[model samples]
Target chain A: MNDRLTAAERVAIARHPQRPNISDYISALFTDFFEQRGDRLMGEDASILGGVALYHGRPVTVIGTRKGKDLEENIHCRFGMPNPEGYRKALRLMRQAEKFRRPVITFIDTGGAYPGLEAEERGQGEAIARNLMEMSRLTVPVIALITGEGNSGGALALAVADRVLMLENAVYAILSPEGFASILWKDAGRSSDACELMKLTAADLKALDVIDEIILEPGGGAHLARAITFRQVDEAISRHLAELSKGKQLGRYQKFRRIGTAVPKKEGQ
Target chain B: MNSIFAKRRARLLAMKSLREHYVPVGSAAVCPRCGKESGHPAVAQNLFVCPLCGYHFPVGAYYRLSITLDHGSFRELYPKLAPQDPLSFPGYRKKLEAAQRKTGLNEAAVSAVGTIDGRRCVVGVLDSRFFLGSMSSAVGEKLTLTIEYAWKNRLPLIVFSASGGARMQEGILSLMQMAKTSAALGRFDQRGLLYISVLTDPTTGGVTASFASLGDVILAEPGALIGFAGPRVIQQTIGETLPEGFQRAEFQMEHGFVDAVVPRNEMRDTLSQLLRLHEKGGPS
Candidate 1:
C-alpha cells in the first residue's frame, strides 16, 4: 500500500472495486510539473512541497506538505512539521505566483509547526501570523486543498485561501484531536471523542461553511488508487481556477477578501 | 551591704555589654535618644532596609541573580544589547537611561547561563525596577536569543518574569514581540526542551499572553499579579465586579493558570529541585 496516495486515489478506488495505483492516473491530470525548494533564509524544508506546474494548461503554484512513505523520510521531515523558515518559504512562493498573476494552490497536511526554542528565537509565530495577514491580501486567486490533517496555527498559516476545498476523509480544526483531548480531558486516549466534538471531518466543515467544497474520495480511502485521486484533485483545481480567473482583474481579487461571514445575531420580534 | 550592692551593679554592667555586642545591625544603626547615626550595617544580610528609618534601596540585577543561581556559577550573556528607543516615544529613552543608572543594569532583563543545583540552565530574570520591567525589543530579543542558546546547548531554560507587560513606547512593534517570543518558545517545545517560567510581582498583558504562560511548568511568586487583561478592564467588559484576589497569584493557581505558588525565600530551592527532577529524564 503506497502511503503517498492522494484524495484522488480514494475517489478512483470508490469508482472501481479493484483499485489502481495513484501515479498511473497523474499523467491524465497535470500538464507540466517542476519542483522548487529552499526557503532562501536557512535552507529548504522538504515537508512543504511547492512548484510551478500547469493544471489543465494554466500555470499555477502548487504547494503542499508531504508525509513520507517510510519512517526515515518522515523522521527527516520531522513528520511534516514545518519550521518558521518553511512558512516563509511558502509565502515567498505565494508572492511569486501572485506576481505572475498565477493562481495559488496549497495542500495542507501537517500536525503543526515545529515548536523548538531555536524556532522561537527565529520568530516562528510571527512568521506564521505574517503569512496569514499577507495571504489574506494577496492580489491573486488562492485555493487550498486540505488533503489530510489540518492542525492548528501551522495549517491556518497556509490554509488561508480564496476557496478552501477538503477531501471527504480529511480533517480541519484549530488543534489536533489529541491536543484538544490533552487540554480538555487530560487524556490523549479520548482523541476519538474529541474529534467528534471538534467537528473536524470534511463533511462537518462543509456543513459549517468552513470549507467551500468537499472532494469525494474513493471507498476505503485514497491509498488504494493514487492515479484516480490525482485526477479528481486536478479536475477540482481546474474548475475552481477557471471560475476564479474569469472577470478577475486587479480589483476582482477583493471578492475573495470576505468569503466567510460570521453568523449574525437575530433581534427580538 | 555597700560592697554587695557594688558587686550586683558590676554584674548588671557586664550583662549590658554582652547585649550591646550581639545587637542586630538594624537595631544598632539608629540612636534611640537623638535619632543620630549608630554604627551598624544600613542594609541587612537579606537586603532588608534599615530598621530605624525604614528606607529601601534598589537591589541590582546581579545581587538578585546571585541569590537565585548556584553560588559562583552564573555567567551573564548579551549584556551589551540594551534598549534603544526606536519610536522616540516622549521621555521613554530618558526613562530607560534613568532605570539603567538606578538599577546599574543595561536593560530590564539579565540573561545568564548558570547552574541551579548542578543542573545547567539558562535564566532570564526581569527586574521590575527597570522601566517596570517592560518588555521592549531588546528584552524580547535577549529572551529569544537566550532560549535559542539554551536549545542549541540542550540546557533547561528558566525565566523569572516580573514585568508591567509590553513597552507601550514601542507601540505595535512592542506588541509584535509577544508573537515573536511566543514563537521562540514554541520552537523550544519542538526540541523537547524544558522551559520553566517563574512569574514574580506583576506579569500582565502581552507578556502574560505570550511565553510567560507557555512554560511546561509555570510557577509564580507569592502575591504576584498574573493575568492577560487587568481586572478593571475585565470587570468593565463583563459589567460586574471581580471576586477578591482576582488576577493574583493565588487566584490564578486556583484557576489552574499557575502550577504552584512559591515564596520568594524558597524560590531557589524549588527551582533547583524542579531542574533536578526534570534532568533525571522524565517523559518530555
Candidate 2:
C-alpha cells in the first residue's frame, strides 16, 4: 500500500476487494461485537472506537482508532486524531472493562491527538496524561496491538497495556518519523532516515524493549491480505490472553505498578 | 629662498604641535575599584564579579549545568531533535538552520541524564544563543521526554531556562507545546518525582507561563529578567512608567515568583544542596 495516502485513501484501499480493513475481518471472526461511545462530558468523539465484544466466547473490550471509510466519515471521525472527549471515552471504557473483569484489548492507529484549538481549550493534554496514569493502575489485563501508525500521545493514551504487540510492518514512536524529520533536519524528505534512527518499526521497537511482541503480517502487509493478517493478530491476542489469564491475580498489580522504575543504584552496593 | 621654505615648514610643524597640546574631553576609562580597563575577564573572575566596576555578568546555562552535575558525568538526550519551520514562515527555516549550525546543537535546549554529586538526575540546559533560546516544538518535545524519562527511571529533573519565549515561526503549535510540556510535568509530579526549575537570564513569554514556573522549587539567577511580558509592553499598556527593576530577579523574589535569587558563583552549591535534600526523601 502507498504510505503517502491520507487516512481517506487508506480507508478506500481497505474497501477494495484486494484489501480489507483488519477491523472488518476481526468483526467477522469474533462471535459478538458491540460499540459504546461518549464520555458524557461534552459530546461523542468518533475518532476512538470502543466497546465490549466476545472473542471466541470470551468477553473482551475492543478499542481502537478508526479513520472512516469515506470523506464524510473521515470528517466525522476527524481522521482518527482524537480529542479530549475521545480520550475520556477510551478511559471510561477501560475503567468499565476493569470493573467487569474483562480483558482490555486496544488496536493502536493514529497520527496523534487532534491539535485543534478547541481540543486544547478542552484540556486534551490533561486527558492523555490522565489516561497514562490511570491505565498504569488498572486491575484487569490489558493488551495493545499497534496495527498501523502509532504516533505521539494519542497512541500512548490507549497503549499503556501489560503487553504491547505490533504488526511486522507497523510503526510506533513518540512521534511520527516525518514529524521527527521535519524537526530534526528542517526537511520532511529525511523521513526515511528518521524512521531508521527513531527505532519506530515493529522490529526496531521490539529490540528497544519498547514493544513486547511483533505479530507476523501476511506477505505484502495487512493491506494485501486482510483475512490472513486478522487471523495472525487474533492468534497472537489469544496466546497473550491465555498467558495473562494464568497470572490475572498473582502480583499482576505490582507488575504494572513497577513498569518504569529504574532509578540508578548508589555506588558500593 | 632656502630661509623662506624653512620658515613655512616650521610654521606648519608648530600648528600641528598646538593641536596635540589640547586635552580630549571624554569620560576617563578607569575602573572604580581597581583602576584598570573594563571588560577584562580576570577582573570579572576576581570578586565573583567584573574586573572594572565589579559588575557581574549573569551565568549562562552551560556553566550552570556543569557546576550542578558531577564532574565528567553528563549524557545528553535528544540531541538530534532540532527545530523546523512547520508553517513555512518566511526566513524562519533559515534562521533555525543557522542557529543549529552556529551552536552545533539540534535545538535551543540541551537535555541530558547525569549524576549530581553521585546521585542520578535528569538535567536540561537552555542556551540563550539560539534565537534567545526560544521554546519551539523540539525544545518542548525534549523537555516532555526528559520529564517522562525521569518519571520512568525515578530520577529528579533539573532544567535551566533562558528563553525569550515561544518560537513564533511555529505559530499556535508553539503555544500548544506549553500545555503538552506542562502535562508531561504533571505526570512526573503525580509519580512523586522532583522537578527543579532554574530560571536564568531573560526567562520570559510562554515558557514562563508553563513548565518553567511549574517546578517544585523555582530558582532564578541574580538580576535575571523573569516575566510573562516585556517591561516595555506592560509600561505601554498601562500608560505609565513602570517601577525601576520591575520583573527583575530581585523584584520577582519580592513578589514571591522566585524562591531565591542565588548569585552565579553560588548557584551550583545551592542546586546540589537542594538535590541532596530532595533525593533523601524522594519517591523510590
Candidate 3:
C-alpha cells in the first residue's frame, strides 16, 4: 500500500492519452464487429458507439463510449461526452440485445454527459433517466467495464450491470476532482486534495463494494502494455459472462438495490 | 393577441423577480416579484403565492405535506435514518450535522404514507433547505423503500422533487443513488402503478435524471428550474448567455419533457384529478 500510486496519480494514468480505449478492446477481443449507429428516433451520435459482435464464437451486443485517439478525433467524439442521442442509441442497442437474448457488454470512459444548450433542448436528463430505468429491467445479462474515467450519471447510465469491473488505474467518480474541488472548496487548484478525498481509484471502489473486481493492469499503465492489458480484461469479461449466463435474472436490479445499506444510530444514544 | 412567446417571456420575468430580496416588514409580507406589501396572514391564506405577481415561495417538505395531504392522514417513514460519512470526506460530517440542525431532518428527503384529497398514496419530498436537497445514500434509500412500499401496498406514488443534484460530499456513493432509485422505480413500473412526479423549484442533475423524469405523468410547478445541468454550468461551458426562461418549468414543458406547468395554488386539485383518472375504476 505504501508504494501504490496515489489516487491523483491513478487519475492521471487513467486519463493518459494513449491508454487502451473501447475500440482497442473491441478489436482485440471480439470478432464480426458490426458497428451500429443512430437512435432511430434521432440522428447518429459518434460519441457512444454500439453494435452487434461475436465474442468467442458467441453473439453479443457491445456498446461503449469512444474518445478520439487524436485532437481532430476528440472534437468529433465530443471528447467522449455523450449527448441525448448517444444515450438513446445505447438504450436502443441494449433493448436489441434483450430481444435477441444476447448479453450486453458496455465500456465506460467519459468526462460526463454533454453540457451544451442543444443537449438540454434535446432532453439529456430524460434520455439518461430512461436508460437507468430500462437497463435495470433488461432480462439479459449485462456487464460493464470502466477502462478509464467514469464520471457522473453519464457513466452510470451505461453501468447498471449485473457485474461492474474496473482496471487497476481506472477512476470512477461522481465528477472530476477539479469539478468537486471547485464546487466544495471553491478552488479548482485543490484537485489533488479532492482526488485523495474522493477515493476514485479502483482499489478504493472495490473496497467500498461499488465495483465487483479490479482487472490488474501491467506495471506503469495499460498503454505501456496494451496486449497484456487486453488479455487480462478479456479474461475477466469472459469469466463474468459465463457466471452470469446461469439464468439468475433480476440480479442486476438487486445488485444495485443492495448498495449503501447504512443504518443511522438511534437518537439519545 | 396572446402569442406563446409573449406569455413565455412574461412567465420568465415573474420567476426572475422572485430571486430579489423581499422587504422585511413586521407582520407583513412583501411580494418579492412585485415589491408590493400585503398582510402576512393574507399571503398565508393564499398558500404563500405572491398576491401581486403570483410568485410561489419554496416550501419545506412538511409544509408541502400539510397542505397536500388529508388532515391527520400523514405517517412518516424512516424518520431516524441519518447519513454516515461513508468515505470520511473532508468537512462532510460537520456539514451533515449543520444541515440536520438547520432542516430538522435526518436526511434531505422525507417519505411517508398519506391520503391526497382522501386518496391513499405514498409521498416523498426532497427538502431543498437540507443541503440544497442533494441525493445522498440515505435519501436514496428512503425514496427507494417508499417506492417499494407503494408497489407492495398497491397505492399511487407522488414525489415532490427539489434538489441541487447528487451530494458531492458522499462522492461516488451518491451517484449510485441515481441508479438505485431508478432501479426501484423500474420494478414499480412493472406493476403498472401510478407514479406522479411533481418537480418543484430547482430540480437538476442526478435527481432530474432518475425517478423525477421516469414518472407516469411528470408535472412541474411554475417557474421551477428543471434541467440536467444548472444554468451557471451551461453558461460557463458554452460561453453564451442563456435564453430567457431557459430550463424553467415552462421551458421544459415547451420542450416536451414535462407534461404541464401547474401553479402552486392549483397543484393539489391537479394531482387529485390525475390520481383519480388513473384509478382502476371510477374516482373513489
The CA lDDT of each predicted structure is 0.65, 0.67, 0.88
Candidate that would win on lDDT: 3
For model 3, state the Cα shift of residue A184 in Å.
0.4
Question: How much TM-score does chain B earn in each model?
Answer: 0.78, 0.81, 0.88
- Per-residue lDDT tens digits for candidate 3, residues A99-183, read 9999999999999999999899999999999999999999899999999999999999999999999999999999999989999
Q: For residues B95-209, write the lDDT of model 1, one tens digit per residue.
A: 8888777666677887888777777899988877777787777787778778878999999999888887656555434544554566567667778888999887688655765
Score every model by TM-score.
0.46, 0.53, 0.93
Total backbone clashes of model 2?
Answer: 2
Tell me the lDDT of candidate 2: 0.67
Off by over 4 Å in 1: A1-28, A248-269, B1-284
- Candidate 2 backbone collisions, by pair: B43-B51, B44-B51
Predicted complex 3: DockQ: 0.61
Q: Which ten residues in a row have the lowest lDDT in candidate 1 chain B?
A: B14-23
First chain TM-score, candidate 2: 0.86
lDDT of 3 at A98: 91
Decreasing TM-score order of the candidates: 3, 2, 1
lDDT of 1 by residue, A1-269 (tens): 23354433322332232322112222445557777888897888887777787776778887777666567977777667787678888989999998898888888877666655334435554466556556766778888887777766677667667678876666666555665565556787876666555656666566655577887766566655566667777788778877777844323223222222121213101
Distance from true location, Cα of A83 in model 1, Å: 0.4
lDDT of 3 by residue, B1-284 (tens): 43464455445333422332222224688666688888866776777788778877777777777678765666677778888889987788998899777666788888778777778999999988888999899989889888988999999999999999989988999999999999999999999999999999899999999989999999999889999988888999999999999999999999999999998888999988998899897776
